[model samples]
Target: MNQPKKMALIAANLAFFIIVGFFVYQRFGIYLNNPWTRDGQVRAQVIQVTPRVSGTVIEIAVVDNQHVKAGDLLFTIDASTYEVSVQQAIANLERERVSSKGAKIEYERLKDIAAKDAGAVSDKDMIRREVNYQQSLSRITVAEQNLIAAKLQLEYTHVYASVDGYVSNINFQIGSQAIANQPILALVDEHSFWVFGYFQESQLNKIGMGNAAVVTLMGYPDTPIEGRVESMGWGIAPADGTVGYNLLPSIKPVFQWIRLAQRMPVRIELEAIPDNINLRFGMSASVLILSEEDSP
Candidate 1:
C-alpha cells in the first residue's frame, strides 16, 4: 500500500472510534444518572420522650433499646408531690362544695323571707347574700378545675409510650431528676419507617409520586425492601446562603464555571417490613426506581 493511503486509513479508523466513544459516553451518562442513587437513608419520626411533670425518677420500667407498644409504661416519676397536690386539691374542692351548699341555703332562706315579708330582707342584704352564693359557686368551679389539673399532673408521673417503637438510649436512671418538658430519652417510631433518597434535580423528571422503588440497606444488601414514593421535599437550605453569627445572610462565592445540579429528597414509604429485618433511623440505604413495565 502507498504511505499516503495508509495514513488516510489510520485517520478514518481514529475518527470512527472517537465518534463511537462520544455516543457511548452520552448513553452511559444517561444510564448512570436516571434511576438510582446511593445517597439514601432509612429514616423515621423520632419521638423525644420528655417528662411533663418534674420529679425524681423512682422506677425505670423499660431499659434502652426495648421495644414498647403505645401506652406501655416507660418510667415512673416520684408521685409523692403530685399525690399531695391531688389530695390538697380534693380537700379544697370538698371544702368549697360544703361552703357552696351552705351559701345556697342562706340565699334561699333570704329569698323566702323577702318573698313572704317584703320588708324583712333588705335589698342590699339580699344582693350581698346572692353575691356570696355566686362567689362560692365560682370558688367551687375553680377548685374543680384545680382538682382535675392535679389529677392530670399525678398521672403524668407515670410516663407511657406515646407510640409503638424501640426506645433509644435512656439518659436518665432511677433517682435521676427529670425536669418537666425536658427530653430524657428518644423513641424511634417503628411503624413510621421510611427511606429518603436524594436525587439530582435533573433526574426528577424520571421519578414521580407513587412510583415503585426498591431500597437495599447497606447492612442487608441481599434483601430489597419495596416502597412507593410518598412525596418530594418542597425545599432545601441554599448552600450559598448560610447564616452568620450576626444573623445576616452570608452569601458565599460560587465557582461560575461549573454548576452542579442540586439533589432533592424524595420520601419513600416502605411497605410491610419483614419480621426478620429491623429498620432503624439513619441506616444507609440505596434506592432504585423501577420502571412501570418492570414493576410487579
Candidate 2:
C-alpha cells in the first residue's frame, strides 16, 4: 500500500480498538479495586489523669503498658501537707463555732439584765451584740468551706483510673508536680475496633451495606479475616478533608490527562476476631468483595 493508504489503515485499526475497549470497560472493567481492611489496633480512650489541685507526686504505683481496672489507685501525692492544712482549717472552724456560742450566751445574759432593769444596757449595746453574733456565724460558714477544701485536697492526693483498660505512657513520676488539666496517661480499650476503607464513587453501586468482605491482612499472612460492609458514608471526603491536608495534584499537564476518581471512606466491622490472633491497627490489608460478579 502507498503511504496514505497505510496511514488510513492504521487509523481504522486504532478506532476499532478504542471502540472495543470502551465497550468492554463499560460492561466488565473494575472501576475501583481499592481493597480496604478492618484489623485496626484495639483503641483505648486516652484519659487525662491529672490532679484536681496542683501537688507534688509522692508515689507512682503503676508503670507503662500496665493493665488496670476502673477505680484502681494509680498513684498518690504527698498528703502530709494537705493533712496539716485540714487540721488548721478544722481548728479555725471550731474557733468560729466557740466564738459564736460565747457571743450567744453573752447576748442572752445582757437581754435578761435589761428586761429586769437592773443594768443600763443601751439600744446600741443590743445592736452591737446582735451584730457580733451574725459576724461569728458568717465566720463559721467561711471556716466550713476551708475545711471542705482542705479535705478535698487531701483526697486528691490519690489518683485512680476512670475505666478498665491498659495503662499507656505515664507522663508524671515521683516528685513531679502535676497541675490541673495536665495529661497523666491514656487507657486503650481492647474489646474491638472498626476499619475505615476508602472506596471510589463509581463502586458505590456494587459494594454496599451488609455485603460480605474478605480482608487479607499481613499479620496472619494467608489467614483471611472475614467481615462485612457495615455502611457507606452519605458524604464525600473533601479535596481538603476534615484534616487540613489534601492529596497532591496529578503530574500531567492541565488538559492531557483524565481526572482521577474520588474515594469515599466505608466502615467495615469485623464479624469476629480470634482473641489469640495478633492483628493490629494501621496494618495494610487487601479487601475484596466476596462476590463472583459485582452486584449492588
Candidate 3:
C-alpha cells in the first residue's frame, strides 16, 4: 500500500464514523422525545361488596371470579331476624294508627262540644285534648319511620351486585358471619377499565386529552388495544415535601448533579375492548400516543 492510498483509507473511515455518529444522535433524540411510556398499568373501579345488615350468610349466589351483572344476587344473609323486625315494626305502626284514630275522634268530639257551648268544655280540657292528638300524630310518624327502616334492613339481607364486574377476593361463604359495612368481596368493574400511563413530565407537551393511543398489555402483547387520552392527573404525592413527625415540612436532600423528570399519570380511555382479550385490574401495560399520521 502506498502513502496516498493509506491517507485515502483514513479519510473514508473518518467519514463513516461521522455518519454513524450523526444517525445515532438522531435516534437517541427520537427515543427521548417519543410520546410513549412502558410504565403503565391497567386500572378499573373496584366496588367493595359490603352488606348493610349483618347476619350469617345463608346462600352464596356467585362464586369467586364469577362474572356478574348489575343487580345480580351475590349472596344472601339470614333474614329471620330482619323479618321479625319488620313484623314488629308493622305491629307498632298499627297500634300507633289505632291510638291516633282514637285521639283524633276524642279531640273532634271535644272541639264540637266547645263550639256548641263555651261552658260545656273547659279551655284547659280542650287544650289537653289537642295536645293528645298532636302527640298521637307524632307517634304515628315515628312508627312509620320505624317501619321504613325495618324494611330497609330486610332489603339489605339480600346482597346484590352494584355494577357489571367480576367478583374477586371473596372470603365469605355459606354460614359465614358477615358484619355490617364490612367488605366481603370486591367487584372489579369491567366497563370502567382504563389504562394509566406514567410518562415523563417533559414529554407531556406532546400528549393532549383525546389524543389517540395504542396499548399493549403484558398478557396480550400481540393484540394492540386502541384508546384515547382521557385526562392528565393533576397531582401526585410529593416525595420530599411531607410533614415530619416534628411537624415541619421535610424537604429531602437532592443531588445537584443528577435530576430526574417527574412522572405524570395520563388516563387512557379504551375504545373497544376485544371480547377475546380479558382485562384484569392492575395488569402491566405499555402505551404509546400515536402521531396524527399513525392514528387510524
Candidate 4:
C-alpha cells in the first residue's frame, strides 16, 4: 500500500477508537449515577371477595377475569331461605302488634272503670294490666328489630363488588356452596398499581423518598413508565434462626469469604399511565432511580 493510504487508515482507526471509548465512558457515568434493578415486580391491591351470607350460588353475574365496577353484582346466592326468614319476621311483628293493641285496650278499659267507680277495679289489677301492656310493647320492639335484621340478611344474599376492579380466580359455579366469610374470588384494584424494586442494601443511600424513577416492564420494553419512590421496606423476613425440628432454632451456615448483599424492597408509585399501557399484577419490571439533577 502507498504511504499516504497507510497514514489515512491509521488516522481513521484512532478516531474510531476515541469515539467508542467516549461512548463507553458516558454509559459508565450514567450507571454510577443511577441505581438500577431488574429484580422488580408490578404490584396492586388484591381484595378477597368474601360472601357475607352462606348459601348455594344461584346466579353468577361475572366470569373469570372480567372487569367490574363498584356496586356491580358478582353473584347471587339462593335467597329462598332468606325470603322465608323475612316473612316469618313480618308475621311475628304483626302478632306482637296485635298483642300490644289488645293489652293497651284492656289496660285503658280497667282504668276507665276504676275512675267511674272508686273500688270497681282493684289497685293490684290495675298495676298488673299496666305491666302487661308495657311488656307487650317491649315484645313489639324486639319483633321490629328482628324484622330489620332479617331484611339485612336478605340483602346480603346478593353479593356485590366493593370496588372498581377485575374479578379473578373464579372457581365456583352456580351450584357451588359459598360459606360466609370465606374468600371465593380475588379482585385486583385497577387504580392501585405500583412497582416493588428489590435493590441492594448498599444502593439504599442513593435512593430516597420522592426520588424520580423510570420503570420498564418486561412486557413493554420500549415504553418507560414514570414513577417516584413512595417508601422503603423497614425490614425483611429473616432467612436463618427459624424454629425447626425438635423446636430448636435453625441456623444456616454462611461462607465468610463471599458475602452477598441483602436486598431491600423500595416501593415505586407509578404516575399517570398512558392509554396504551396496561399494568397487570405480578408482571416483571426493571427500575432505575435517576439522580436529582437528571430528574425532570
Point to the candidate with the largest lDDT. Answer: 4
Off by over 4 Å in 4: 1-28, 114-125
State the lDDT at 187 in candidate 2.
Answer: 65
* lDDT score at residue 276, model 3, on the 0-100 scale: 78
TM-score (all chains, Cα) for each model: 0.84, 0.62, 0.83, 0.87
Per-residue alpha-carbon lDDT of candidate 1 for residues 222-291, written as tens digits (9 for 90 to 100): 9989999899998988876578869887877668997888999999989977777888889999998866
Candidate 4, after superposition: displacement of residue 140 in Å? 2.0
Q: What lDDT score belongs to each candidate, Candidate 1 first?
A: 0.91, 0.72, 0.92, 0.95
Q: Using TM-score as the measure, what is the rank order of every candidate, best first?
A: 4, 1, 3, 2
lDDT of 3 by residue, 1-296 (tens): 99999999999999999999999986566545559899999999998888999999999999899999999999999999999999999999999999999999999999999889989999899999999999999999999999999999999999899999999988867899999998989999988999999998998988877889989999999998999999999988889878887889888778999899999999999999987799999999999886665557
Off by over 4 Å in 3: 1-33, 241-253
Q: In angstroms, what RMSD does candidate 2 have relative to the true structure?
A: 12.4
Candidate 4: residue 244 lDDT (0-100): 97
41 in model 3: Cα distance from truth in Å?
0.6
- In TM-score terms, candidate 2 sits at 0.62
lDDT of model 4, residue 267: 99
Please list the residue runs of candidate 2 whose C-alpha ends up more than 4 Å from where it truly belongs after superposition: 1-42, 113-128, 191-193, 198-273, 277-296
lDDT of residue 71 for candidate 1: 97
Candidate 1, pairs of clashing residues: none
